[model samples]
Target: MGTVYQINKGLNRPISFKGLKAQYIAYLSAGLVVLLLGFTVGYILGLPLVVLLPATGLLGGGLFVGVNFLSKRFGRYGLMKYLASRRVPVYLWFNSRKLFTQLKIGEGYGKK
Candidate 1:
């Protein structure tokens, strides 16, 4: 038999599943797990299957849709970048230029 090598088309690429990408896959999985636990807890607490079933189904549907939407809307790293950008202030508030004026070019910190 001749040697056959399988090619890895997804090498160095973000993990994707059924239209969800990267961290969004984790998000969807976590959400589903939470839903599953909630369903189990409710069922153990004597809640009606009628109520638990529909609630779990609706929340699971929402989780899938939301995660897929975020993956498409934000790409792989866009969501993280967007979240990081939100931490930045819109404008820097400076009362004086003393902080900038004290900087000596090419000088390391604490060097007199």
Candidate 2:
């Protein structure tokens, strides 16, 4: 017999965009799209090219660089891990399974 195989083997393929590996492609593409949309919307809104060009350039550049830096500093899984680590907690509780230790519809956690 050969090596064991997973049932969801298709999911194991590395995520990529264009020829670039990992999330770089996604970041670049999204940045470019934002750049284009910024210009288009600015033009339609009658903003001057002088201001629009620089503003869009900075916006797009910042997004592109930010994304690239994030991806590089944190590998595929690391990026999500980084984000999760910084997220605020939704559930806060002590030891007891008292009256308000569960999730509520519109009320704050641990509060009535």
Candidate 3:
């Protein structure tokens, strides 16, 4: 889960993410290891040309997907709010408790 934020109406929303921090860090670390292996193999095999480009491209593509997934999952709250705001029924859930309590309190005060 990503950070939770309260909207202006005081309702909490949760953010989701694809990979956790540690897993992401570990994935990058493994990519670095693969990159180093690619470089070393190229150096030892004297094939200076062919392998490096493909290796880098593969590693880069993996990182791109990982980052994109993370952002989309974690950044969804604004979208959720937009969806909720567009529907009156959705917004009412957030306000119903407060509205009911206020009404009850007003009725009691008036009775006194």
Candidate 4:
């Protein structure tokens, strides 16, 4: 059996399902925004839409890679701190205590 927990931020408590849905929606919105901006810029510059497509693809790919690299380098604590400060709800598979314990063990053994 799995348990779900609600994430609270100050006076606002967004339902966990809502937060998850919002995150996906945000990603979709970002992609759409990028595409629209690229199209607009390309039109203004008299560039072919085909060229803009590749440029947008490259930019989005690079951004995704960079974000992943940074997140990997920073680890969970860094990500948690960042999310908490930004008032974003973080959903985890386990409770904080178990998560921290696993993190410590993994860090200790995995370090070179």
TM-score of each: 0.75, 0.55, 0.35, 0.37
Candidate 3, pairs of clashing residues: none
lDDT of 1 by residue, 15-85 (tens): 77788889998998899999999999999999999999999999999988888889999999999999987
Query: Where does candidate 4 have its weakest 10-residue lDDT segment?
Result: 13-22
Q: Which lDDT tens digits does candidate 4 get at residues 1-112?
A: 8998855644643222322332333444586687778778888999987888788888777756655554455543565567675674455334457656556544768576
lDDT tens digits, residues 1-112, model 2?
8998656446667675434447767778877987898799989999999999999889887976677677667766787777776684757534567656674676765565
User: Which segments of candidate 2 are over 4 A away from where they belong?
Assistant: 1-21, 87-112
Query: Which has the better lDDT: candidate 3, or candidate 4?
Result: 3
Models sorted by lDDT, best on top: 1, 2, 3, 4
- Candidate 2: what lDDT? 0.74
**How many angstroms is residue 54 displaced in model 3 relative to the true structure, after the best TM-score fit?**
4.6
Order the candidates by TM-score, highest first: 1, 2, 4, 3
TM-score, cand. 3: 0.35
Residue 65 Cα positional deviation in candidate 4, in Å, after optimal superposition: 0.6
* Cα displacement (Å) at residue 97, model 2: 25
- Please identify model 1 stretches exceeding 4 Å from their true place: 1-7, 92-112
How does model 4 score by TM-score? 0.37
